[model samples]
Target: MVDILEKLTIVVKRGKADKNSPYPPDLKGQDGADELTAEALKMGFTPDEVLQKALVKGMHLIGEDFSAGRAFVPEMLMAAKAMKAAMKHIEPFFKSGSVKQKGTVIMGTVQGDLHDIGKNLVAMMIEGAGWKVVDLGSDTSFEKFLAALEEYPDAIVGMSALLTTTMVNMKGITEKIKEVSPKTIVMVGGAPLSQDFCTQIGADFYSPDPQGATEYLDALVKSA
Candidate 1:
């Protein structure tokens, strides 16, 4: 398990998707996330083991680097792709109830905001952290959020808005979510958002980047 865990983690962190993936110059032609994950499963490693020990660990390391400025968007995106490749092998187990996730997260770009770059980054980060992500996509309205919340009652909400003009809608959306689900936690982020704005809008948290959101959610899981 230790050997497989480390191998899978390295391939995923290096953004190597499969035997044929050539993105990483050094690891070219080697088994990647796809092949390594499949092999691990065949060897009897549990889905949760692959997720928590490999996929989540690899993504967390990359997220930390991105947060520290040691890595940039391209690195984050690549690592996410590798993580997704590994996920394809384990998703069936999660769906079949063989393993339980850390939690559920509902992500969306606020209404009137069409930008999704930041939202997508955060969703990928959170999903890689081992939580189930339900993305509502860009221009998501309060009603849409409400519908999702109805389906996942205990889900944490994450909202995004990259445009200053459209950001005000976050306040309304947060209010509506709180009105019906007072216990639900709400996190907000984007280029134009700040911790002060998060407080003003009644959101529980705010982050400038995907790594921050990932850490926040991971901490919540630990404290639970």
Candidate 2:
């Protein structure tokens, strides 16, 4: 049902969680991402189809809107909520190996950066893009990151820093990861980050927004 799939996308993009969610006045009380995703599954739609076609498609639109400044944190947060609600029904498939993820992505905020909004956004976007995201939360240290890498050898590392002071710690963390696992790719982001700074810190990529990070990871997975 192309029509149902399209509605799922709209529900996600509009941040509808379920019939009870009232944030978006226009579609209040309408069946949101939760019900629609479950309905799609009941209709025999494959999990991969729901993820790639419905979820990722909707996230891409939100990402583009964020990149163009058409959407702010509130909008993106709502989108992430919708994505999570949809994911609740499909995560079991991933765990059961019925739906394999593109890759694992280990993410966290660097030490001294207690903020989690940026890190959470990146993690949500990455997960919505079909990666198995291992979120380490805020104020994470190098040892913790290295431990996560050891657990998921093929995972790419994403580090976030909201404060300029804490951004320097990203360099130390990257170096440690490279020293232990030279092949690991480290991506850095947050308000104060720049591409040149990312290079200086020996990180592989730097994205100002979640959409950019998603695109970078998608390209990397495709190439790999």
Candidate 3:
């Protein structure tokens, strides 16, 4: 069981999705995250074990490598693809309430931004890290965010903006959210954002990369 879990970790980190997935040449023809996850379940490992031990661990490794410059965006994308393949098998447990998630994350690109690349990537990274992600899509409004918050009171909010002009909107959105739910955690990021900008906007956290964001959230989950 441990060995299968390790293999699942490697396949996910290498971005192998299945026996036919050909993205990572080094892993061609090897059983991928998709297959390994099913095998693990067949081998009697629980869904939570497969999630926390293999899928999350694999993404964490690639994320840390990305943060340290040992990996890059392409690698992260492939890793995410692999994780998604595995998630096809594990998702049912979440719907069944048999596997616990770290927490819910409400993700979106701020209103008027029309940019979703960075936002989508962070959503995938956070989902790979064993959390439930509710994507609000690009050009999201404050009312929609608030509605989602009302539905998921304990969720963390992540906002993205690609334009300098649009980035300014985060300040107002963050203020409104904090005013409504003082305990809600707000995360802001985008190419134009900085730690100082994040502080000025009154957002609770900021990370330049998806991995950094996931790490911070994981720490928060552990502490909680």
Cα lDDT tens digits for candidate 2, 1-224: 77788999988887888889997899977999999999999999999999989999998888889899998888888988999999999999988999989899999999999999988988988888889899999999999998999899999999999899999999999999999999999999999989999989899999888988989998997887
How many clashes does the backbone of model 2 have? 0
The estimated TM-scores of all candidates read 0.96, 0.98, 0.96
Clashing pairs in 1: none
Give the winner by TM-score.
2
Candidate 3 local Cα displacement, residue 32, angstroms: 0.9
Candidate 3 lDDT by residue in tens digits, 9-124: 98888889899988898788889999999999999999999998999999989888878999987888899999999999999998999998999999999998999988988998
Residue 191 lDDT in model 3?
Answer: 96
The best-first sequence of candidates by TM-score reads 2, 1, 3
Total backbone collisions for each predicted model: 0, 0, 0
Task: Give stretches of model 2 more than 4 Å off.
Answer: none
After the best TM-score superposition of candidate 1, give how far the Cα of residue 149 lies from its true spot, in angstroms.
Answer: 0.7
Residue 120 alpha-carbon offset, candidate 1, angstroms = 0.8
The digit string of per-residue lDDT tens for model 1 on 111-187 reads: 99899988988898999998999999999999999999999999999999999999999999999889999999999
